[model samples]
Target: MSYLEFLGQYGDRILSGTLVTVLLTVLSSVLAIAIALVTGLMRLSPNAVLRGIATVYIEIFRGTSLLVQLYWIFYVLPLFGVTLEKFTAGFVAVGMNLGAYGAELVRGAILSVPRGQWEAALALNMTPARRMIRVILPQAVLIMLPGWGNLLIELLKGTALVALIAVADLMFQVKQINGTTFLSAETFGTALIIYYVIARFMITPFMRWLERAMQRKLGRA
Candidate 1:
């Protein structure tokens, strides 16, 4: 059968899976950003207790594999009477695992701010919250934007793993099509192209825009 015919035949099923992938990416990314912001700031905190907690959380999540975490959440949790839906387990694991990695980016971005800025904020009697929210945070955003973009792209690709957990993501649909038609190359190739379009056309340009906006805000544009 022609590739076009194959595509037309199973397009709906594939589109459904793509929708799931898109939803997972959006949900996990927002959560990851929040987690990155908190843990990132906590990592730079002066309080040893807070820093230690943030450090431990990052280490635990980053050190472990995402697939293992997903399995633990979906399968093992049930052993303890804490069953979760497959989609929930998938997003939670992806968000948490990526959040740990993102926290490091946040830490580096914050620290990249010039020391003079922090000192000036202090001299001006700016509260700690004010310093971060008003001063350091803006500057840090320029640095963070690139790293955040990279993480978001990773999240987009990472959605493929959700299929393994029965979340019906793009990869799951591709596999289903392949099974029914025995056309592995066509199904997987189409999915790969779709992912590339999302990452290259959508995600990359958005990140560039964000970076430019942050730089303009800093008067560095």
Candidate 2:
């Protein structure tokens, strides 16, 4: 069959797969952002205990392979009587893994903020939480925007791994189509184009808009 005909036949399946991929990406990205912010702040906590906990989490997730983490969470966890649905396991694994990396980005960005900002907040009698929220994080977020954008793109590509957990993401659907039709070139090529389109047209644009918005908020635009 021609490419158009093939697409016509399987378009619904492709759409379903695309929707699943988008869902996984959005959910995982949200989780990763939250974890990064919390763990990154913990890394800078005055309490040694908090810093130690963050360090251990970062090391464990960053040092290990994500595939192993996925297997452990999805397959091996049942041994300990903890079971997560495939989609849950997939996003959790991906989010935690990426969050470890993003935490470092957050830490670095926060550190990059001028020391004067912290002192100025202190002079104003701002509490630690208030200082960070009002004075520090606003500046740090601009520094971290590019890094976060890159991480988000990586997260998008990484969604392919979810297919291994039977989450029915784009890659899973493409693989299934290829297996049945043996149309490696068409199936895989379509998937490649779709991913590129999503990244280029969706993620990239959103990131750019976010950067612009932040810049305007900070009066840099």
Candidate 3:
């Protein structure tokens, strides 16, 4: 079949897969950011225990391959009597892997906030929590935007790996359509175009908007 015919027949399936990919990206990114914030703050905490726990989490995820982590969560965990649905396992693994990288970004951003700001907050008699919430994080978020934007793009790309776990994401559907139609070039090329469209038109623009909004909020735009 011609590429146009293939698309006419399989377009809905491809679009469905794209929606699943988008859902995975959205869910995993949110989880990753939450994990990054908590663990990054813990890594900087005065308490030795919190620091140690965060250190272990960051090192373990960063040290290992993401595919290995995903397989462990999906396949290996079942042997230990812990079973997760494929979607959940995939999202958790991707979130955890990216969260490790994001933790360092968060830490660096927080540290980039000038010492004078911390001192000013302290001088104002603000509690540590209040200092972070009211003074420190706002400044740090602006600094972190560029790094976070990159990570978000990485996370979107990484969603392709979930197809291996039978998640029926865009990549998975591409494979299915290619196998049945024997139109590998058309199927895979279209998948590539879709991914590029998502990253270029959707994710990048949104992140840029967010950066501008944050800058405006900070009176720095």
- Clashes (backbone N, CA, C under 3 Å), per candidate, total 0, 0, 0
1 versus 2: better TM-score goes to: 2
Candidate No. with top lDDT: 3
CA lDDT of every candidate: 0.90, 0.94, 0.95
Model 2 agreement with the true structure over 1-221: per-residue lDDT tens digits: 99999999988898899999999999999999999999999999999999999999999999998888998999999899999999999999999989999999999999999999999999999999999999899999999998988899899988899899889999999999999999999999999999999999999899999999999999999
- Between the candidate structures 1 and 3, which one is better when assessed by lDDT? 3
Q: Which residue pairs show collisions in model 1? A: none
Show the lowest summed lDDT stretch of 10 residues, model 1: 210-219
Summarize candidate 1's per-residue lDDT along 1-221 as a digit string, tens digits. Answer: 99888878998888888889889999999888899999999999999999999999999998888888888888999999988899988998899889999999999999999999999999999999998999998888787888888899998887788899878999999998888888999999999998988899988999998888878877898
> Taking the tens digit of each residue's C-alpha lDDT, what string does model 3 give over 1-221?
77787788999999999999999999999999999999999999999999999999999999999999999999999999999999999999999999999999999999999999999999999999999999999999999998998999899988899999999999999999888878888999999999999999999899899999999999999
TM-score of 2: 0.98
Model 1 ranges off by over 4 Å: none
